[model samples]
Target: MLLSDFIREGRKALLALYPAPEAGNLMTRLFSARLGLPPHTPLVHPETEIPPASLDLLQDDLDRLLHGEPLQYVLGAATFCGRDFKVSPAVLIPRPETELLVERALAAIDGAGPGCRVLDLCTGSGCIAWTLMLERPGLCVTAVDLSGEALAEARSQFPDRPAPHFVRADVLTQPRIDGGPFHLIVSNPPYVLERQKAQMRRNVLDYEPEMALFVPDGNPLLFYRAIAGMALTQLLPGGTGIVEINDALGPDTADIFIQAGFSDVSLLPDLSGRDRFIQFQRPF
Candidate 1:
């Protein structure tokens, strides 16, 4: 089949599930990934042909998209902080907004010097953990997650680099820090309320790991409280921390850190003008 024909049909099929622009976007991305072409390369090469051997495989991928599978999971990879990271249903696909968390964390580490200790809580897919280590090669990072399946995926992020210390620990419980205090703590833990599930699309609610995405509706700040408690004890003097929060609960989330003794708590907004993160510092 011609690649253009496949794309046209695939986009039409996806229209049943997504709006026109988004449906076109997903097909373009899938074509780019499969054909090793620039996304815009397709418009210029409208007559490109799919090698006969590859048609069935590409069709199977389109069928998956039509059925509500996430594109990242379909591709088995997610681009985060300008690098591709491994992703599976076992972990949440890294979102662009979370890249803000990565940027803030790296900025917090800029002058902290070599061998600074950094910790990542609920290190799904090791996206943040691996981005920090790769972007600034001198930091010693320890990433903890309660899910063994998640840890296994995080460990495989960058095979050639010195990977972060992947540890298994329930972030909700009191965790003993063995490598002394950390200079920075960052997490993008579960903060979605169960009630909000009704607002989400099946591509996320049905396919992504629920354990990594939600908390009880009655107490949506559960993970924040536990993580802040960990940060309070684990951060070194003058240390800093950042965590991604549900945009709607910025102040409530910030209060969790403030009440836990982080005096410099400040909420930061994402590109969309929603309060998306809270940064706090342990006093010197």
Candidate 2:
């Protein structure tokens, strides 16, 4: 079949299951991947014949999409900050807004001296950790995730980089792993409330790991609180803490950081201008 025909059909099928922009984006990406084309390349011309195996692969992906699987899981990877990272049902797919957390961390560490230690708690695909290491080669980064499967994926994704000391530890646990006195701590931990589950799309609530998304109904800020407390104890006296927060919970997140004794607490907006990050410094 021609590539355009496949994309049109795929778009139609996905639109039934998702919003137009999401469906269109997923279709375009899947089609590009099948044709061995860069993601931004124009869709293949209608007269161009697609290889049989490619057609079969595209069909399988479309079936997965129709069943509400996240496109990132289907693709087996996601792009974050211009780098590709392996993704799976074991890890929450990295979102573009989460890049704000990385930017804040980068800005905080820009003038810091060499040998600074950084910690990325709940570091799903290691997106934030890897980005930090890439941007600031002088910083030593350790990434922690509770799911062994997610850590395994992160380890495989960055084999060349000094193996990020991956720890299979929960963020809410006491006595964090002994890699700090970290100079900076960053997290995009699970912040979605249980009550908000119904509002999420089927692809996210069904395919993405629940442990990486939903918090207990009454304690939506549980992970934030846990990370903040850990940062207070583990970060250097003048270190920084940067976290990606749900836009709706921005005010509450800022309040939590302040209560945890972080100074210079501030909330920053994402590309969409929604409150997306909380950045603060530990008191000296």
CA lDDT, every model vs. true structure: 0.89, 0.85
- Give candidate 1's TM-score: 0.97
Candidate 2 — which residues are off by over 4 angstroms?
38-44
- Name the top TM-score candidate: 1
Q: lDDT per residue, candidate 1, 1-284, as tens digits?
A: 77888888999999999999999999999989987878876589777888888778788899999899999999999899889998999999999999999999989988877799999999989999999999888899999988999999999988899999999988888556566599999999998989899999989988999999999989899888887777778899899999999998998899888888887899999998999999999887
- Clash-forming residue pairs, model 2: none
- Candidate 1 local Cα displacement, residue 100, angstroms: 0.6
Ten contiguous residues minimizing lDDT sum, candidate 1: 171-180
lDDT (tens digit, per residue) of candidate 2 on 104-125? 7898888888788999999888
Q: How high is each candidate's TM-score?
A: 0.97, 0.94
Lowest summed lDDT window (length 10), candidate 2: 38-47
- Give the CA lDDT, 0 to 100, for residue 92 in model 1: 93
Candidate 1 segments exceeding 4 Å error: none
